[model samples]
Target: MDLPEIQSIDDLALLVEKLKLGLVSAATSDEYEFSDEEYKRIRKILLSNPMFTELIPSYLKLCRNLSGVWQYIKHEFSTYAERRGFHY
Candidate 1:
């Protein structure tokens, strides 16, 4: 299948959803938990993506080096100035 072009932030949001990472949420009260293996997978997948540098460079760097939980991603993505989730 052909992939859609990443021409806008909305496209990125759509792509992220399909990755199954979901929108991040802050751990202000409750934190989501993940297995050690899953955590490693997240880190590995994130660290390898260079496109993040073009979107939110600092935030992407933090996600690559410092993030540990799903909530952190949600919180970080919250900075995106558009409505999230699959729109179609």
Candidate 2:
């Protein structure tokens, strides 16, 4: 699948929706794993735009398959309250 360029929050929302659909489809088979390149691209985007960081937790809750990506985000933006909320 092609990763869309996320210039605005709407774009990110669409990407998240697409990912959720992909997860639903992949659930019938094996786990879904993002390619290394895709991972790097997403990481770069998040790093460059901290405004979109709030979406990480929502994505994690929707798809635990991407825990590694969540870990990276958690590490990069560790807030005690947010981490506690995620754990519980």
Candidate 3:
């Protein structure tokens, strides 16, 4: 499935959730990998937003799976509070 346009932080969060589900499905079926093209698209979208710029580099390096991405987001922004702030 094609990714949706990320117009806000909420959009980004939704994309991440979709990616997580995709990753889980891929792992179970052993038939897919998150393509480099998809990563580039995601990177481009995030870099377009100043609020997400700080996350792109580390995220590119460390976010190979949902758990890694989740941990990084949680570690950098806390699990709940900072994420809630981003949405508002």
Candidate 4:
């Protein structure tokens, strides 16, 4: 499938939702884990994307909030089939 063009934070969030879903599915089906390289790639995608760049500050803040609990955050993303709420 063709990837959607990201041109706004909403678009980025939507893309992230898809990615999170994929990660969850992969974790179950293929035991996927984020490698350092893969993590770098994700960060690169977000920072390089024009739309995501516009919301970098908010993104950074979110990251800061989750810094100590990154493993928990990853586990949540990797297993949850649906996003339950907007606590993030």
Which candidate number maximizes lDDT?
3
RMSD of each: 8.9, 9.1, 8.5, 7.5
lDDT of 2 by residue, 55-74 (tens): 56554433334445455446
Using Cα atoms with residue i matched to residue i, what is each candidate's TM-score against the true structure? 0.30, 0.36, 0.40, 0.34
Runs in model 2 deviating more than 4 A are 1-5, 17-29, 54-88
Question: Which regions of candidate 4 deviate over 4 angstroms?
Answer: 1-18, 21-30, 55-88
lDDT for each candidate structure: 0.41, 0.49, 0.55, 0.46
What are the runs in model 1 whose C-alpha is more than 4 Å off?
Answer: 1-26, 35-40, 63-88
lDDT of 1 by residue, 19-59 (tens): 33322322222244433444344444444556664643344
- Residue pairs with backbone overlap in model 3: none
In order of TM-score, best first, we have: 3, 2, 4, 1
The residue-by-residue lDDT of candidate 3 on 1-88, one tens digit each, is 3545666778878766655444433333334466545655565565566776676556645565455655555666643545444333
Q: Score candidate 3 by lDDT.
A: 0.55
Q: Model 1 shows how many backbone clashes?
A: 1
Highest TM-score model number: 3
Residue 81 miss distance in model 4 (angstroms): 8.5
Residue clash pairs of candidate 1: 24-74
Off by over 4 Å in 3: 1-5, 18-30, 57-88
Between candidates 2 and 4, which one is better according to lDDT? 2
Model 1 — which ten-residue stretch has the worst lDDT? 21-30
* Candidate 2: residue pairs that collide: none
